[model samples]
Target chain A: MNPANGGWLIALTLVAAMLLGVVHLPETWPGWLGWLRPNWLILVLFFWVIEVPHRVGLIAMWITGLFVDVLYADPVGLNGLILASVSYLGWRFFERLRMYSVLQQCGILFLLVLGAEVLSVMVLGLGSERPWSWHVLVSALVTMLVWPLMFLLLLRLRTGLRVE
Target chain B: MSALLITLESSTRLLDPLRSFIGSLVSPIYVVAESPYLLTNAVGDVLATREQLQQKNRDLERRVLELSQISQQYVALKAENDRLRELLGSQGRLPYEVLIAELVGVIPDPTTFQIIIDKGADAGLSVGQAVLDAEGLFGQVVEVNRFTSRVLLLTDRDHAVPVRINRNGVRSIAGGTGDMGSLVLENVAISADIVEGDRVETSGLGGRFPPGYPVGIVASVVVEPTSAFAEVLVRPSALLDRSRHVLVIFTPQPQIESNDANTDGVVDLDQGEAAPATNGVENAQAGAT
Candidate 1:
């Protein structure tokens, strides 16, 4: 972390990701495009958690996710739980995550996002859940596909800005 | 701490103020998120032709002319209905004031059907005020901040409206199934005169919503001989996913902010004057025939 800004650059990136995650699609856009709206906040947090585990860990991710919960008007802590559970696994596997190629990390990210979905269902309950659509896996698969580009972009931003 | 919050926030609304405050803090984020749609709508307006504008103007003027004619008769009919209600020893209908508000955003989650309106507590809005579009009932205001409120639309899985059949005056309940286009009427007996295409309107039994506004049209009725209740599907008459402007209704009757922790979202008309609105199982059995 920098001496003067104290990680404000990281804070700005997370806020930018939160804003982008929620921008609505055009009214004339097709309905199926909604399934492709990746969980932007988590993807960015995964980058920061994997890169700077000493600074950005479960608590920071949890608080950032609380803002997402507010944006979506979800119950206050559901997203916090999703972010914390997912990022904790990222922290656990960081040495190997850093060693692996981006595509392989994409595979691991898919499992983490899938695990987050399972946590969401368990917390929210299956009483009124939609019929098994397999879209959960599709959405997770899409989030995984998004990771390599997102990772490179953030890496360039960190080095270009000299954030640390 | 998050586990504690999850339990406290869901089981009881011990966390509502915290949620509302955080929701307000996030409004700036919402404005940034909505800018793209705002830009597109502005571009569409610029591209519209003068002839199209004239056509829309003519259609609005014709609509105003027709509505004025209906309202003149409505005043007379309402006065006469009040006299009859007095004769029958019943409560007279209180007048309602309507305010117009624009939709700012629709909550984008697939699992919920909620929208944000531009008006809020500063505009005299309160939780439980009924919302409507030109065509039919839309939803009710659930959370009111300084500048905006969240409306739980009629199709949210947690929403239920007390309704009546316009054809037969039979009372029933319509519960949302998390689908934007339809709601499911609960516990309809097989013999109930409700049929496909029957108009369903607010019954005004719960007193939260004003009675007689169109809620939905009966889309289908499935009566299996072995099953005890008919599966009544209602297509909401209002365009839940399309409408841009809505009307907020202020019914003159005093309201108790319905606490969802206790009631199943149906509120009492008046705590002192009306029979208990809480006993729904018996109420359904009594009203189904």
Candidate 2:
């Protein structure tokens, strides 16, 4: 398999998962299993941004954010801006992150997820005069806590998609 | 390398056809991705069956208590009406049409605090439609899509619902302060008759929402000396987070207004339009369909 074909496969899988994450309608509130949400999209994109920075750059994040914006009908460009910023940050630290073990990478990814949540709340809550709640912080914590599983999934995909 | 080059030449030529075929095959993946609950629903059913029974028991107890309170309210309302009638003339009752819809999901973000409902354009729902539950005003429809609509919950930070204290008729705008069950009364005078347990209802100042729907009950009142205003925290009347269904009222005002505009044009064309005749025709059409 050509390297270019492998990249396309990864891109296709990411977009498909992201879009599915957007359209999914939970029939009932499984508050117990609420932890199982596909926080995978951000982590996958993060992995690509770190490993293949040029291929999945700021533009890819922006488009994913816009897709989520349309799917959720949130204030337009809010999520896109946050995603692009995260991608940029991920690209900048790609070399540094490349040196770390999976467990260490998971710790840093937790912080990145927290930063993303804060950026989302700050952007959306600004000027709207809505009272800020601890829920945003809670969500950020939840996102970070899921880092190990998210990282493992991305690791599996990377190995599976590797071409000889 | 030579064999690969030959294969690439053939595949490059077929790329357009192959891409479209691949796109078609992958389209269903997104749809399947959207229903993550389908994977968990069967297991959830077995687990949730006992919990559902317990929830029903709790609901029954709540209903009994609500019934007793409602009876008390009716008696109090009748007494107030009699007193008001002696002071000022009675105004006729307002007519409204109610559409019932089920709550589908809570919006993922807390900033917007919107709920997506299953009803949409197909249900004759228009933007800015007022939504209410049996107890009180819940929120309004802000965005409408094909099969679903987004409702900006009153508890959302950006939204402001005009409300008045039922005790002294002190009016103030209530804004969401990032809580699922709370809102703050902005710019109310320090002397306002707002107290804990006071009922707050829509003032109907703006034609945005109909009058007299219960908004919430005052939870706490805090007055700071430095500030010229008082802080009133309210717990909304409807159990919004717990509510599974809501009523979207569709009053007949728009249709009436459009017909009146058409009547004016008809009268100008004909020397005298049959006023009583048009009334019967309009009434019959409204009744028939």
Best by lDDT: 1
What is the lDDT for B7 in model 2?
35
| Chain B only: TM-score of model 1 | 0.86
Q: Which stretches of candidate 2 lie over 4 Å from their true place?
A: A2-40, A52-60, A85-96, A103-118, A125-127, A131-145, A161-164, B1-94, B223-227, B254-289
User: What is the CAPRI rating of model 1's predicted complex?
Assistant: medium
TM per candidate comes to 0.88, 0.65
DockQ value of candidate 1: 0.52
Candidate 2 lDDT, tens digit per residue, A105-144? Answer: 7777767766766665565453345455665555556656
Off by over 4 Å in 1: A4-6, A126-133, B255-289
The positional error of residue B286 in candidate 1, measured at the CA in angstroms, is 19
Model 1: lDDT equals 0.77
State the C-alpha lDDT per candidate: 0.77, 0.63
Lowest summed lDDT across 10 adjacent residues in model 2 chain B is found at B279-288
- Candidate 1 lDDT over residue span A71-148, tens digit each: 876667889888887678778877878899888888888887787766665665522333445667876888899998
